[model samples]
Target: MSSTLTVTGGAPLKGSVAVRGAKNFVTKAMVASLLGETTSRLRNVPDISDVAVVRGLLELHGVRVSEGAEDGELVLDPADVEVAAVADIDAHAGSSRIPVLFCGPLVHRLGEAFIPDLGGCRIGDRPINYHLDVLRQFGAVVDKRPSGIALSAPRRLRGTRISLPYPSVGTTEQVLLTAVRAEGVTELRNAAVEPEVLDLIAVLQKMGSIISVDTDRVIRIEGVDSLTGYEHRALPDRIEAASWGAAALATGGDVYVEGARQPDMMTFLNTFRKIGGAFDVDDSGIRFMHPGGPLRSIALETDVHPGFMTDWQQPLVVALTQAQGLSILHETVYENRLGFTDALVRMGATIQVYRECLGSTPCRFGAQDFRHSAVVSGPTRLQGADITVPDLRGGFSQLIAALAADGTSRVHGIDLIDRGYEHFAEKLAALGAQAVRDEEPARV
Candidate 1:
């Protein structure tokens, strides 16, 4: 759906809001259900498009996905999973990053499987080469086909030691899901220990999977003979929480983000403090407010877990525009993520993309043009203008920029935002922001 945002400029949003299950975590957990020997029950599921897309993909496999009366509850049965949907599977592979995760489970259950192309944010060339390497280590013969990825393993899969070149969340989850059913123990080094990955591990553990996380970026999973179903509650969306929190900071308002857990926000909180954003945490949720001090610019570098998340960079950058002085942002995750700043420039923010990475840290954006890094000269006036969203967190940054700007701003391609944010319109309305769901102007 299309969205038009009209803001009067410089209005601090004041209200209480709540978040739901994480889009990233829930979608992968849905894929995890395929490994279940019995029905798996998942609660706190978000009503986002990505979840629906995954549900449709499961149904194509003959899995039954039924929603509960309560919001975000689901019953998943994998007994009817179809092993031969090359065309349908190919179509969905380009939709989200979770589709490639089916490789291991499909290989374990049917001894053969095909997965279509995978799709997600265009921040970088997120290749599945690492995933394929790990799968091969598990004794699966994998090949790339014109339609999708084809795999076969007549022999019982044997787990082997694998290492990731990067701490990719998708790659880590893929290895975890596939290795669990293989024979012997699998060791993964340089794994992505995102909270979502840990949450999926928790679900897998309940389903009788043996996995262990070491302090030094190591993960050990033992392949089991059979697996049972599980009842699990999805983790809260930390990226969404940070988005709203950044919105509050950008708009100079106070918002209590309900259902926002603090355990996942230490990095964000520390960064927010550097910008003079104040917050308090309670059992109900967290509250964000600017302490009426000058917003200071700070250096930020994105890394894997226990570090600032790459997903949170774009939205937080918008808030940085209101801060004083030059803020140095080095994106170490994806190369092309900084492109979203161009949209923000149209709305009157002073940001310059750079090819030279100046920071001393080991950032990934050094070779790439502005796609990797940017300099935000903030404390500038932002006026509302029509803008189009390019990605998930970038979409929310557009909304935050529009709300902070004067006059009306129309944000198109908002359906992309629904892939992550749940009930966003309703939440924005509740928080005293005048945002509406409207159709775009008909082409002449």
Candidate 2:
């Protein structure tokens, strides 16, 4: 049976919580360990289901994953890495999209890699075609079966020039993982340079890969003949930090998210300030809260990198419901991320979804007739309602709405949030939010 959360709303949440390594970067870095000649130590690892999923996949491929020198650290030994049976991989893979990332490292080491049917959040058309295309460009053969895809590199995989249709983070990561081991120089155009991607690049550099980033969204990598394991700390999760900042705004409370860095979150920080939310950043972390005043509404847009992140828009939308006027948001990264706002509408939020682009940016989805724009009319007093968790970010967005509403709210399918957010219920309690697991049946 699935777990649910019963939340009593209309209370302010205050206090502090710590964020660890990013779920996006840490998982990819674990896959990168496969290319190492020795053991790799990854620090600041968060306790999230996605990390466990990656660990399971690594162990299945004969990599030894163990505890590091201290807590929130992982030691990955790729010295004895060997190919495992297909059934073993599928059995351990579960419903994770991480297996697709293993294609490059596995092919480079064992010359063949089998991928299980990949699954992740139902965000949008996040296809593996781009990854497969990149692999094929690097002289890898792709074969599709009922179970999953199999990739084989018959000859020494050599680097090739590639250009992405969009600046996709996953595809860019796949190329980085593959190109670092190829025989020659690889150039990528229209590449995504998200901070998480840069952290992965740093991990690769620590392992002896020579990569250069050009100013015009171009990345060049010179494959090294060999690589050693790396000892490095992963970057903190900016998405999680921004979610908590939005929580502080939605609940009209103060929250100090320790370990949140400013450089990576500059875009989000500036946007949060324009909304009339208060924040203070130091060397440790950022403290976010709502000052007693009228919250102003503003037009916002989500983009790839160096722009407002699409992941940050969900929870921030909950906070926008408390703003004095309408706030328009254009989601360019993912077309369907705004679908989660329907539950908010059920909880007395005034949100209208439109096919046209609503914000300042003209995105590719503008002409595609997708419901990519949302106009939030707010300062609406939200009431409690039963809701189901949709995806990772959306699940947290649901929790924010439930906490901002009056009375109690029953939230089901909350286990999905474990995929990203670490120890969220504990963090909520520490913040003085009345959120508890509902062991009993729901009240109808």
Candidate 3:
């Protein structure tokens, strides 16, 4: 059953919050554990639902999984793995995008793999075409079944040259995982260089992968015969950090985002500064706070990497509503990302969705009724209301907006937010935000 969050409004949050290992990278790294013969001891792992989902998939394949007392670490014992439970694999395959990541590793270990359908944030029509196409290029036979993807590598895998139409993060990860264990050299251009992707590469390298990154977004990987287990710490989740930063600015409070890396978050940091959010970064973490006066609004475009991230745009847009000036946001990653913002509009935010493309930026978004662009008129006085969560990141945006609004809010489908966020209820409490779990059903 799903859960709901009841938030009492009007709180000034002040506290130190530690970020978790990235949900994106850690799940892929867990899948990589299947490729190695030794046990994979992953550190700084987050206690998120996605991680639990991946852990279930790994253990279903006969890998022994164990956890520590602290929520920061996990041990994946893939030494006795058996690819026997196709039904369990099929059930979870439809649950997340990370299950599709296991295809390359499973094919390498068991010669054939059946992957269930992938489900993630419904921001756009996220096709697995590039991923399938890249796998096919590596000489794997792929058949799209009703339940999942059936894959077979008849011969030993061989890598080839591949370039993505767009620098998609999932497809890039697919190519990296499939090509690293295949024969010959694989060259990838226009690859995703997100921090998560880089962390995956770091994990692969520790597991005996020979990967080299060059200028102009080029990546070359040499396939090896065998790989051993890897022990490594994951990079801090930038999305979670950005979400809390947005919350701090929106609520006119001070928050220290511990374990957040500054170098990987320069784009977000700069944009938040433009929005009148002041921050200080040391080796440990980042501290975000509001200035004395009204916060400003800045134009934003969500791009692949080195650009503003698509996931960060939703929560940041909520903070923009409290800004004095107008904010223009062009969602370049997903077409339907702005739909969840409509819930904010219902709570007194001045936001309008547009069909036309705002400007010519490097994005797949075109002139259509996709509502890919959002224009928010600021200084909004938001009133709390009952909100339903459509997806993980969108749910957190609603939570932040609700915390910043007046009165109380009942956020339904709160469990969806827990799929990615770690210790959010306790963290909210730590920040002086009053939140309680409602046992009764939430009224839509």
Judged by lDDT, which candidate is best? 2
Better of 1 and 3 by lDDT: 3
Candidate 3 runs further than 4 Å off: 68-71, 440-444
Per-residue lDDT of candidate 3, residues 1-444 (tens digit): 668899987676789899879898889988888989898889899988888888888888888989855567788888777775667776765657777787898888889887776787787898888878888899999987787779999998898999888988998899888888999899999999988998999999999999998868889999999999999888989999999999998888899999999988999999999999999999899999986689887788888888899899989998999998888888888888888897899999999988767756866668466888878999989999999988888889999989999999999988878888998999999899999986555466
**Tens digit of lDDT per residue, candidate 2, span 347-412?**
999999999988677588888868988999989999999999889999999999999999999999
State the lDDT at 116 in candidate 1: 77
Taking all chains together, each candidate's TM-score versus the true structure is 0.96, 0.98, 0.97
Task: Report lDDT per candidate.
Answer: 0.85, 0.93, 0.87
For candidate 1, the per-residue lDDT at 4 reads: 48
| Candidate 1 vs candidate 2, TM-score winner | 2
lDDT of 1: 0.85
- Clash count per candidate: 4, 0, 0
Alpha-carbon lDDT of model 3: 0.87
The count of residue-pair clashes in candidate 2 stands at 0
Model 1, 1-444: lDDT tens per residue?
Answer: 255444445578889888889988898899889899999999989888899888988887788999876777999999877775678776765668767777888888888877777788776788888878878888989887787778899798898888887788988998899988889999999999999999999999999999999988899999999889899888889999999999999999898998898999999999999889999999978999977877999998888888999888888998999999999988888888888888789889999887777567786557655557788998988887878778878888888898888777888877778889988888888888887787666445
